[model samples]
Target: MSKRKTDEVTGVETTGHSWDGIEELNNPLPRWWLWTLYLCIFWGILYTIAYPAWPMISGATQGVLGWSTRANVAAEITAHEAANAELVTQLVAADMPTLPQDADLNRYAIARGGAVFRANCSQCHGSGAAGAKGYPNLLDDDWLWGGDIDAIMTTVRHGIRNTLDDDARYSAMPAFGDMLEPAEIDAVVEHVVSLSSSDFDAALAEQGAVVFADNCASCHGEAGLGNREMGAPNLADAIWLYGGDRATLHTTVEQARFGVMPPWGPRLKEADIRAVSAYVHSLGGGE
Candidate 1:
């Protein structure tokens, strides 16, 4: 081994390893820093022994303490279920129409129904229930069926145009593509447009009036007002389901618009159906 040399100016010892022009100084590491490094190693060893740290071929090693995030979540969920058991039981058996009579139940139902609506109904009706082209707006007074609480509940439970459910609300607008000529269809479209507004050819509307009286009056009434009992929408109103534009009206008249709402009764709990109904009814449009 080579003997260590002292630097003249600084009086520091050389590390005895140097290049042709430079010598390295042998400096001692700070005590605090060395202690901190040792403490980190000790802590790492403790952590490995106390918690899950090692990985195996198939799974991780279980530490001394029996802790699992999945188990904790399950326990919390169980506790929450237990807490809501009584309310859920009451909601399950409660009369749908008289739900609001019990203030507490109604309040809880609305809150819970909001969550259920977001998860289930929001996809079609929208999160705010404003509705899209095919879907009916729940926030508006116009309803294909009645807008009463019981009516909403009935609709939610049985659904509309759901062929699978025996009690589903059913109706069909006959497709006039095969029955009517192009001129006759055009005349009828003009007549339907005139009933709502004068945004059509007067001569065509006059010709179409005869067609409307003969073909549409049976269900849509002589005055063009809708028949709720038959599920015929009020055409005279500004609000429309599939829209009342010329193109949309033509498509509706020719092909006939038949939208389907899946029955929630088969999918959700009884409590959930009631809850959603109540939530919808509270949206300022329920009669």
Candidate 2:
């Protein structure tokens, strides 16, 4: 319990408490360390005064810089737009056919179009335009309307199954549920399925033959070869729009499912529509 002097030069004292005969020093904190601690406190106070630091029930204080995350993002976008002025100009002026000549411009438009498509079309068409059961795959060559660049552009410019747009692509498939009885629809379904393969229920197809002639033959043709002028799909080709499954067939018969593709022309810039059309047309089935 004896006190001791540790530093003779400064006469620093040691704590009277000891363990194993080793005492604890009672030296003051180093001047440099104390100054650094004070500096941190001052910096914090200054930072609070200069920036939005205080928290209230409503919101934090508006910093002197008057900065916001949204403002920062807008500024960045503005800067980017300014930097790409020339490219944007080119995109606006260039036609779809000539776009491939300017690789940089084409690439920029494609990137922009891809972002737009992801935001808008990805929900139904899928991320890669693979499409859902009812939706037609853009990547495939099975187009209900047409797969040419001009055709795609026309489709995109005028949405299908949409009555809202005056120029919307409109076509009506006979609702077997309303037009014919369940038994008759079943017969037609069996007949339609049979077209894909050699196996077919002859009895059901015989019954369906009358129904097909009366209701379907007008657009689908007597042989079910399809009428391109009416955009009626070739039933014999095995490219089912809704699906080839029995359930999908039943649903199609029960209720005529109309797949609608939104027109991008009114919503998106011309350049973007052209780029997306080109990209979609290049997906292997483009005529």
Give the number of the best model, judged by lDDT.
Answer: 1
Native-vs-model 2 lDDT?
A: 0.78
Q: Tens digits of per-residue lDDT for model 1 on 1-287?
A: 67689988779999988899588889889999999999999999988888787999998877788667778999997897689889889988888778889999889999989989999999999999999999989998887789998899989999999887998888889888888887988999998998888678999988988988878888889878888788888888868898888888988888998899999999988878988999999999888
For each candidate, C-alpha RMSD in Å? Answer: 6.3, 7.0
List residue ranges in candidate 1 displaced over 4 A: 1-77
lDDT at position 30, candidate 2: 96
Alpha-carbon TM-score of each model against the true structure = 0.73, 0.71
Model 2, span 1-287: residue lDDT tens: 45666755556687666889676778789999999999999999888877778998999987787767878899997898799888877876777666667888878877776776787778888999888777777887777778887778778888787865787777778677887888988888888777776787889888888878888889889988887667788888887767876678878877876777776668877766776776777556677
